[model samples]
Target: MSYPSLAPYIQKRPWLMRWMRPLSEWYFDNAGYRKLGLRADDLIPEEDEMVQLALKRLSPKEAYDRVFRMRRAFQDYPYLSPLVKEVMAEQTEREDLESMVINKRKAAGEKKAH
Candidate 1:
């Protein structure tokens, strides 16, 4: 499951972005995944459908790189999370389209004429 975030809001305000940048970096740095050579996105569970789809969409090189990093405990920038988000958004849109109900309302003038 994806967690809700204030990242968009914080990013839109330069002052807030500046204030949070160091704190966010500090948190990520101390989170210990890097020590294990795992990027932040690597922590996302593979049980998620979006994540699974994103993994499939990964380029061969990226896929290989991810495996290599995990094997060697090497660290890298985030790559999968953005793809997962894209997949999730596409799925949500598809679901919304499938579930949409269109209502056709007759005009008052047409009813009167009938």
Candidate 2:
């Protein structure tokens, strides 16, 4: 799963958020994605199966818009970030579970062989 972020903690403190807002804005602006007509989420790699599944789940209009943005950015997308994050988290969890199961099965098989 995606590591826990400090973002929520920082955001919950009004003073910290206020202090960080300008710096965050500056960072975002300078990141250059906007110049490429891409949102921060658009930079996420789509090679993951989770990402592909999330793309498939997008609404038709949203999917069309995402494609258009990607084409524009190539010359890139709101629900996208949350959806991507959720998928990534799920994928990680699944991987972890699969590894645990495999390890258990391997250990059991080794015991049987011995």
Candidate 3:
């Protein structure tokens, strides 16, 4: 499931971005993850299947970097989110295609019965 985010909305409006920039930075700075040297994405749990799949899809170097950052408590950045989104999108597409196929089969069966 896709979560709603204001990022794109704020980015499209220069004034909003300007206003939110400092506040966002302040929040992030004080969010305690920075103190721990962890990125925002690092806080995301690995228990989710989507996240697990995303991790599996990462390049060897990227996977190593993720482990290194976690072990070293490095600063935060969103590295895995895009891959997670892609995985979710692919799943949704597959589901939709499967449903379409099922519906088509049902329609064909009904036509033959008539």
Give the least accurate 10-residue stretch of model 1, judged by summed lDDT. 71-80
Instruction: Give lDDT tens digits, candidate 1, residues 1-114.
Output: 988989889989999999999999899889777677788777778898999999999999999988887867534556678999999999999999999999998887775454
lDDT of 2 at 101: 40
Q: Which ranking of candidates, highest lDDT first?
A: 1, 3, 2
For model 1, the superposed segments whose C-alpha errors exceed 4 Å read: 73-114
Whole-model lDDT for model 1 versus the true structure? 0.86
lDDT of 3 by residue, 1-114 (tens): 556889999999999999999999999998766776677777777988899999899999988877887987644555678999999999999989888843334554465644
Q: Can you write out model 2's per-residue Cα lDDT over 1-114, one digit (the tens) per residue?
A: 254778999989999999999998899889876776677667667888788898899999988888888897665334368999999999999989888843334554465644
Q: How would the candidate models be sorted by TM-score, starting from the highest?
A: 1, 2, 3
Model 3, which residues run further than 4 Å from truth?
72-114
The TM-score, computed over Cα atoms with residue i paired to residue i, of candidate 2 is 0.53
How high is the lDDT of residue 8 in model 2?
A: 98
TM-score of 1: 0.56
Top of the candidates by TM-score: 1
The predicted structure with the larger lDDT, 2 or 3, is 3
Q: Against the hidden true structure, what lDDT does model 3 obtain?
A: 0.82
CA RMSD, predictions in order? 15.4, 14.8, 15.2
